[model samples]
Target: MRVPDWIDETRISYDAVAGSYADMLRGRLAEEPFQRGILGLFAELVRGGGPVADVGCGSGRITGFLAGVGLEVFGIDLSPVMVEVARRDLPGLRFEVGSMTALDLADGSLGGVLAWFSLIHVPDGEVPGVLAEFRRVLRPGGVVLIGFHAGAGVRHLTEGYGGHPMNVYVHRRSAAQVAGWLGEAGFTVEGELVHRPDPKTEGAFVFARR
Candidate 1:
C-alpha cells in the first residue's frame, strides 16, 4: 500500500524524537488531573466489555495508565521507534507498530478506542475514514475517546523534542466538528468537553459510543 505523505512525515518525525518524546511526556499524566480523571472514567466504562486499543499510542503512557486503572488495554503507533521505546519503557503491556487508518483487528473486536492527542496529526479529509475504522472495530455500545487541540487550522512544527527537525502538521478541529464526524461514522455523541489547558491552546475531549 502507498503511504500518505503526512503519515510518512509524522512517522519519521516521531521516530527521530522517540526517546526524547518519551522522556518529555513520561510524567504528563501526573500533572494533568483532568486528563487522568477522564481516562479513569473511560477505563471504568470499558472495563468488562473487552480489550481496548490506544490508537496512536505514543510511548504507551496513556496505555499504561489505562492498564493501571484495570482495563485490558494494548497500544499501537505508526512509528516503530515509538513502539520500541514504549515496549522498552513499559514492560508487560502490548505495544505494536500500526496505523489508526488500518487497524489489524477483527470486526467488532474492541470494546473501546482511545485516540489521545493523536488524531491532531490527521488531516480533516481523512478523519471520517479513520473514525469509521474505529467504528468498524468496535462492538455495539463500544466507546471511543478522542483528545485533541481544540480550534481551527494547522500548526507546522519545524523542530520537535531534542531539537530534531520535523516536517509535521498539527491539525486542530472544534469539538462540534469532531462530534459530527463521529456521528457520521456510526457513533452517538456521549459528551464533549472543551477547556483551556494552557494560555496558548485549548483542548477538546469527545466521548462517543458506537
Candidate 2:
C-alpha cells in the first residue's frame, strides 16, 4: 500500500480503539525489558532538560515518564481519539494528533525522538522516507531510538485488541539493515538491544545519534 493510505488506515484503525487500548495495556504494557531498553535508550540518546517528541505516543506513558525525568516532552499520535485520551489522562503533558511521516515540529529542533513500536505500521517500502522525516525533525547531533519487532517479512494486520481495532504491520529487519537505514537517515548507530518482548514478539532496540 502507498504510505498515505497506510497512514490514513492506521489513524482510522487506532481511532476506533483508543480508549480500550489505553485501559487494557496500561500497566500491562510496561514490562521490565521494555523499561530496561528505555533506560538504556535514555543513557545513549536523551539526557535531560530539552525537547523531545514521541511519535505514535499512544496513552503517553513514555512521554510522561520522560517528562518526569525533566525533559520537555511532546507526544504525537495519528489517532485523534488517542490524542484526546492522552490529553485527558495526562493533563500535565501535551499531546497532538498527527502522522509520523510528517510532524509540525521545526527542522533541527529536537534533542531526541522516541518511536517505540511506531514504525510497525509503516510499509517497509516507505520506511526510508519516515526515517528521513525523523532525521529532519532532529538536531544535527540529536538521537533517535526506534524499537521494532526483530525477524523477517511483513505483517499486514486488521483486528482489534481491547475493543480497539488494530491496523498494524510488522517488518522485521536485521541489525545491518537497521544500521544502514539509520545511517541513511543521518543517524549514527551507537548501540542495539535484542530480546523477546513476549512469546510472540522479539524486538530490536536500535540507538542512533543524528
Candidate 3:
C-alpha cells in the first residue's frame, strides 16, 4: 500500500521528538481530574469485555494508566521512535508501531479504542475511514473514546515538543462534528466532554459505542 505523505510526515515529526515529548508530558495526566474520571468511566464501560487498544498511544502514558485501572490494554503508534520509548518506559506492556488508519488487528477483537489527542493530526477527509477502522476492529457494543482539540480549522505545527522541528497539521473540531462522524460510521454517540485547559485552547472528548 502507498502510504500517505501526511502519515510519513507525522511519523517523522513525532519520531524526532519522542523522548522530549515523553519527558514533557509525563505525569501531566495526574493533574487532570476530569480526564482521569473520563478514562475511569471508559474502563468501567469496557471492563471484562476484551482487551483495549490505545491507538496513537505516544509513550504508553494512557496505556499504562488503563492497565492500572484494571483493563487489559496495549498500545499502537505510527512513530517507531514513540513505540520504542513506550516500550522502554513500560517494558511490561505491549507497544507496537502502527497506524489507526489501518489497524493490524482482527475484526471484532477489541473491547475499546482510545485515540487520545492522536486524531488531531489526521486530515479531515481521512477521519471517517479511521473511525470505520475503529468500528471494524471493535466487537458489537465495544466502546471508543476519542480526545481532540475542540474548535474550528487547522493549525500547521512547525516546531514543538522541546523545540524540535516538526511537520504536522493539527485539525481542531467540535464535539457535535465528531459525534456526527461517529454516527455516520455506525457508532452510537454515548458521551461528549469539552474542556478548556487554557484560554486559548479547547479540547474535547467524545465517547461512542459500536
Worst 10 residues of 3 by lDDT: 194-203
Candidate 1 per-residue lDDT, tens place, 1-210, comes to 899999999999999999999999898789989888889888888889999999999899999999888899999999999999999988899999999999999999999999999999999899999999999999998999999999998989989898998999998899999999998888999999987877887999999999
Better of 2 and 3 by TM-score: 3
RMSD of 3: 0.7
> Per-prediction TM-score, please?
0.98, 0.90, 0.98
Q: Model 3, residue 2: displacement in angstroms?
A: 1.8
Best by TM-score: 3
Better of 1 and 2 by lDDT: 1
lDDT of 1 at 95: 97
lDDT of 3 at 91: 97
Steric clash pairs (candidate 1):
none
Supply the TM-score for candidate 1.
0.98
**What is candidate 3's lDDT per residue for 1-210, written digit by digit as tens?**
899999999999999999999999999999999889989999999999999999999999999999998999999999999999999999999999999999999999999999999999999899999999999999999999999999999889999999999999999999999999999999999899998878997989999999
Model 2 C-alpha lDDT versus the unseen true structure = 0.79
After the best TM-score superposition of candidate 2, give how far the Cα of residue 61 lies from its true spot, in angstroms: 1.3
Tell me the lDDT of model 3 at 80: 98
RMSD in angstroms between candidate 2 and the native structure over all alpha carbons: 2.4
* Count of residue pairs whose backbone atoms collide, per candidate: 0, 2, 0
Which candidate would rank higher by TM-score, 1 or 3?
A: 3
